[model samples]
Target chain A: MTTNKTVRLAQRPKGPVKPEDFDIREEDLADPGEGEIRVRNAFVSLDPAMRGWMNEGKSYVPPVGIGDVMRGFAAGQVEASRHPGFKEGDTVTGLLGVQNYAISDGKGVSLADTSLAPLQTWVGGLGMPGLTAYFGLLKVAEAKEGDTVVVSAASGAVGQVVGQIANIIGCRSVGIAGGPEKCDFIKSEFGFDAAVDYKAGNLFGDLKTACPDGIDVDFENVGGDIFDTVLAQMNPFGRIAVCGLISMYNATELPPGPKNLRNVLVMRLRMQGFIVFDFIKHNQEAMTALGGWYKDGKLKFKEDIRDGGVEAFPAVLSELYTGGNFGKLILKL
Target chain B: MTTNKTVRLAQRPKGPVKPEDFDIREEDLADPGEGEIRVRNAFVSLDPAMRGWMNEGKSYVPPVGIGDVMRGFAAGQVEASRHPGFKEGDTVTGLLGVQNYAISDGKGVSLADTSLAPLQTWVGGLGMPGLTAYFGLLKVAEAKEGDTVVVSAASGAVGQVVGQIANIIGCRSVGIAGGPEKCDFIKSEFGFDAAVDYKAGNLFGDLKTACPDGIDVDFENVGGDIFDTVLAQMNPFGRIAVCGLISMYNATELPPGPKNLRNVLVMRLRMQGFIVFDFIKHNQEAMTALGGWYKDGKLKFKEDIRDGGVEAFPAVLSELYTGGNFGKLILKL
Candidate 1:
């Protein structure tokens, strides 16, 4: 008999996530039932959106219920399969939960081609984060050639992909990251047009310097002061794609909105909020474009894969909010 | 020799318009030049945007310069003309300043068809305010059949027309006003489906009760707390046309933005700011529709024409920021 190790939600978080909010347990593993497939999850993806999913109340998606396996996206090889579509030894990825083993009926499961990249890559750039950037920048913001695109949280998974895609589409991509190190990495490694180090305490001026002609498209990930500064610099008829507000995710109380929101009126700007799940119908088109870019050397992804198995889930997940993770955060079971 | 009584901007207003801020004086009026036409103005329009124009910063339009004729829109007959486009007794309306007489070269001038409505109505509903409501509701917000459209400052010039137009287009129109009298007037006089009295001290609950299926479109005229409540009640894929922020215009300092702005993302809402000038190309189409509705008795306009000349401009204009006017506040010269 084998044992499956899993992390379950114990309670709702108050502010920042704490380890006591989750329960790590081991249970007896069962074989695949009728039309079911068993995946031994190799890598579980960590996202800022996970923090929102743990809260109580209505959100883009339902909250992670207490005592249930924590909701997450994972990539792994199938150990057993009773379904005809997926067979043993097949690599797949989906919302398979934060567990050593996941059972699925193949509803949202997608086959991962390992010849293109590793399992961690499948759960990183080529996965939800990559697709988020693809749809948000192209479809929502409608960033065009010769446009100046700005993105916040530039070193994170989705932000990095967004900047790269903007450059590929002939836009001047300016990234906003926390420290000098991450800022330098985005410009040097990711080939971004410019990087504004937000930790330098000159956000408004630095952003103005980076975007001389004013911002045409903004893929806003971080909310609060960062968003306010971007709002002030937006050109007439600019588009803002509100993909995430990670800065407000863990707030115990609701914070005041951007003071420069008046810019939305005076500048005739269009601001729309969107989730990657909202664009599920266009997944195939997005994946084809993203995968093509990845294969042609136009795209690259960095993974911060950690050890200590599923037991390190809480600690590794908390690193994302603290800016401790340098790239696409993932846990190797 | 005729005399022209004009109101010139003495200095930039700090919080609200004061009588001392304007230098109302009479000067010897000159005859029409080679291409200029002199208009004997009868009615001047008052708008919330005028307050923004009084500041010393950038806005949709340049600030009204100190010692210059205070910028305004007015309707009158051409008393004398040397321009080919104009003849004597021709009724017109344009950005003709706040004075008893105006000189124009026929640029941006729109001929008023008094046969359709009165001169006050031209500046009130058939002029900028009407076009604003037309483009803001249909073009900017895209309010269609079955949409629950909400507008703030319900009894004001643009807001009344917005509600009436929504009803004409087969939408459920809801208006937000301050007092009970204004709220009841919107529903009974302007034919709004419902009215939410913001001064009733139960804005959130009242708005929820009025919008049973959730708000689908919001024509935001008043920003601040009223905007925050409507934002919270918005349904998925809702559209918000930010036509005006009357509540914030007279604010002495920058106020915190809507606390519930996060709803824009969670509900996948689209909030766009627009000015009537941005849609000038579509003016003919909008006017044809609005005029047809007005002629068919399906559209109604309420003008609070104050019996005051250009000298009363400062006091009458102050009434707008305080919500003292019951309807479209226009000054009769």
Candidate 2:
């Protein structure tokens, strides 16, 4: 019998998640069922959306119940398999929770290719974050060639992919990041047209200069001031794909909505909020297109990996809100 | 040459429009040019949108310049014409401003049909407000048969029309009005499935009770509390057509946006803001459809015609915000 180290939700979070909100425990793992596969998670994804799942309320997905293993996405090698399609040693990715091993009935489990990309990249560029940017920019925002695309949290997992994809498709990409380091990286490494450092206190002015022709597509991740600023610079018939509102995920009370909402009427803008799961049926199509871009060297990504096993789950997740993580955050068990 | 009594913008309103903000002046009317027609204004349309045009900012249309005639829509008779498309005694409707007489070069002037509907009905049911409800509900909201449609300001021009049209197309319509009388009118006269009086102090509870199946389409006219409340009851993949924000038009300072905007993502709601002019090319189509509904007795309308002529424009316009007017508020010139 294998002893699995797992992090479980101890209680619902009040605001910023405290370490006490989660509990680390060791449990015996049962053998795979007749048609199930056992996965030993190599890398668990730490995302801003995790903060939302910890709260007690309605959302795109249900809240993680107390005493349950913290829900998350992970990429790993299949350790044992009773399923005909998946075999031992096959690389797979699925919602494996924050644990050492996960047993699945093969639902939502996909075979991953490490030959084309690294293990971490499967949870980074070719994972949920990558697909979010792919479908959000191309399908949701309907971004076309020569369009000016502006994205917030440009150094984060999804925003970075959004900026790079915009560039690959012949659009001018402008990124808004928290620090000078992220801003510089987005411009130099990611090949963004312009990068605005929001921490510089000149976000509005900097954004104005970066997008002179006005933002045609706004890929919103961090809502609040960033959303309000970008909204004012949106062109007529602009499209805003509200992917995430990380800034408000941990708030005890929601802040007022964007004051410039009237701009939607005046500019005839279409603003929609979407979840990646809504486009789950089209995952293969998105992965194929994004995988081609990755092979062509037209896409670049960075992973912020933390090594502390299951006990580090709560602490590492905090890095998303604190701006401590520079890239796609992952946990190496 | 004839003398025209016109209401001009004396100064921009700081909040709720003051009578002092307008200046009524007598001016000599210009003769019709080679291709111009002279219209003797019979009924001037007073709308919530006119309040927005008085503010000094960017909007769907430019602000009414100081000392310029207050912009409005009117249905009147063409007394003289040098234009081939129009002649004497022809009823017409256009942006004729707040004046007794208007001269146009035959642009945007549409011949009004008083044969199928009354003259004032042209401004009430076949005018901009009627077309606004038609296109906003069908085209923008994409309301289909069996969809639960909720419209704010249910007793007002656009709102009433929206409810009636939703019913005509086999959709269940719910209306939100201010008083018990208005609420009763919407249910009894307009054939709404349910009506909630926002002034009843149980707005949230009443709305939840009324919309048991959840709102599929929200035709928003009045913003603020009404908008925020309806937003919460929206079902998954709901559509919100932001036709007007009358609640915010007269606000001295813009109020905080709806806090539950995150529902947009969780519910996968598509919220779009649109101006009627965006569908100008389809006016004939919209009018023809709405007119057919009216002739079949399937659509009924009531006009709150204020007999105060052009000088009473400012006072009558205030009735919209105060809920003093019961139906389509129009100034009988």
Judging by lDDT against the true structure, name the best candidate. Answer: 1
TM-score of each: 0.81, 0.81
Interface RMSD, one decimal, each candidate: 0.7, 1.1
lDDT of 2 by residue, B155-238 (tens): 877888999999989998999998998899889988999999999999889999998899999999888888999998999889
Please give the distance, in angstroms, between residue A296's alpha carbon in candidate 2 and its true position after superposition.
1.6
Across A61-159, the per-residue lDDT of candidate 1 in tens digits comes to 889999999998899999999999899999988889999999899777888777777778888898899989999999999999999999998888899
DockQ of 1: 0.65
True contacts kept of each: 0.83, 0.82
Q: What is the lDDT for B258 in model 1?
A: 89
Error of 1 at A98 (Å): 6.3
Looking at model 1, residue A207 earns an lDDT score of 96
Error of 2 at A64 (Å): 4.6
Q: What would you estimate as the lDDT of candidate 1?
A: 0.90
Q: Report how far off residue B310 is in candidate 1 (Å).
A: 6.4
Chain B TM-score in each of the candidates: 0.88, 0.89
Which docking band does candidate 1 fall into? medium
